[model samples]
Target: MKTRIKKMSDDLLWIFYPTLCAACDRPLLMGEECLCTFCKYYLPRTHFHLQSINPVAKHFWGKVPIQAATSYYYFSKGEKVQRLIHKLKYKDRKDVGMYIGQLMGSDMKDSPFPKPDIVVPVPLHEKKLKLRGYNQSDFIAEGFAKSMNAVFEPQMVYRNKETETQTRKHRFDRYMNMDNVFSINKELAASDKNILLIDDVITTGSTLISCAEALLEIPGTKLSIASIACA
Candidate 1:
């Protein structure tokens, strides 16, 4: 009876204010959550986790030692993936992060990727966190932790300084801006544990580099990175 009542309520709600897909903006069916089935099936998957020398992994070469790194989707200008990211970051859509993380988890489940003992998100600056009311990466980390059977440490590492925006900045400028911006708690990262550092996206990867540098200092901690997309 509860299920039937819910079905009726969903139908009525759809009639009054139908749901729409986050990526495609199509009207969602009653059972669809966050995105329509079609979007879920067709959203681009990078499959970088399946390979040994994926682009994401190579991006860190000579910079930081990482066991592996890959994004679930390829981000491009004027694309549905871009739209999804915009919603996740700027539009207060935490569900978009969780959905993408869950999709990403499916790839990690049986892949060559290293299993993580603790999942840590790239920390948001206190000012940015105040403006946004939540860290988008934490939402993604939560979903990934749920699927990967790992502990989620939302505050293990944090932004020590607020850096200037990376937008339209040169790679060197981005690097300088992010340098020493992140600091980690040594005791929390733990020794002899594999730590997966997660974020919403990777561009020049300066931000991740700063965070990884701090995380790697933890004795016996192995580091890997994952993101929702790579531009």
Candidate 2:
């Protein structure tokens, strides 16, 4: 009876507040989660988790050696995926990150994706972190940690230099700019363990490469990458 009453109260509150889908801005129905049924079906998924040599893995070829790479969705410009990214990054909607990460974790739970020793998010520079009041990717990492039962290490590495956004830069420029800009923690560096590197989004895979390079400095450290979405 108590559980039913709480559910009823939550339902009553939603009628007054009208919860909307984060992706499509449609009113959420009784059974819908973060995204509406239409948006969930329409959103492009990479299904990269199923392949050993997916496109995301190919991006790191001849660059960083990664165990595997997967992204939850394919990002298209002006799409609902961007709306989810916007809310998570700019609107202080940290739950959005957790929800996406949980979905990714659930997918990989029974897949061939190797289990990780720990989950680390691409660290944000202190200045940007201060302005944003939180690291959006940290929430992603947390959700993944919970689902995968891995340690969530938010401070495993940090941005040593604040770099320009990679949005307009050429691929080479992005790689060059991010090089040597991150530093891994000694605790993580001293071990030969698998680390699951996480981020909110990936484009040209420059940022993940930079981060993986830092983690590889650790003896016997194997790297795998996961992101909420990728272009």
Looking at model 1, report the run of 10 residues with the lowest lDDT sum: 182-191
Q: How many clashing residue pairs appear in each of the predictions shown?
A: 0, 0
Please give me the total number of clashing residue pairs in predicted model 1. 0
Worst 10-residue lDDT window for candidate 2 reads 184-193
lDDT, residue 40, model 2: 69
Residue by residue across 1-231, what tens digits does model 1's lDDT show?
999999899788898898789999999886788889998888888889888698888889999989899998899899999999889999999998887777788779899999899999999999999998889999899889888989999988989999888998999899898888888775576888999999988999999999999999888889999999998
User: TM-score of predicted model 2?
Assistant: 0.93
Q: Tell me model 2's lDDT, rounded to 2 decimals.
A: 0.89
Candidate 2: list runs displaced more than 4 Å. Answer: 1-8, 188-190
How many Å off is the CA of 23 in candidate 2?
0.7
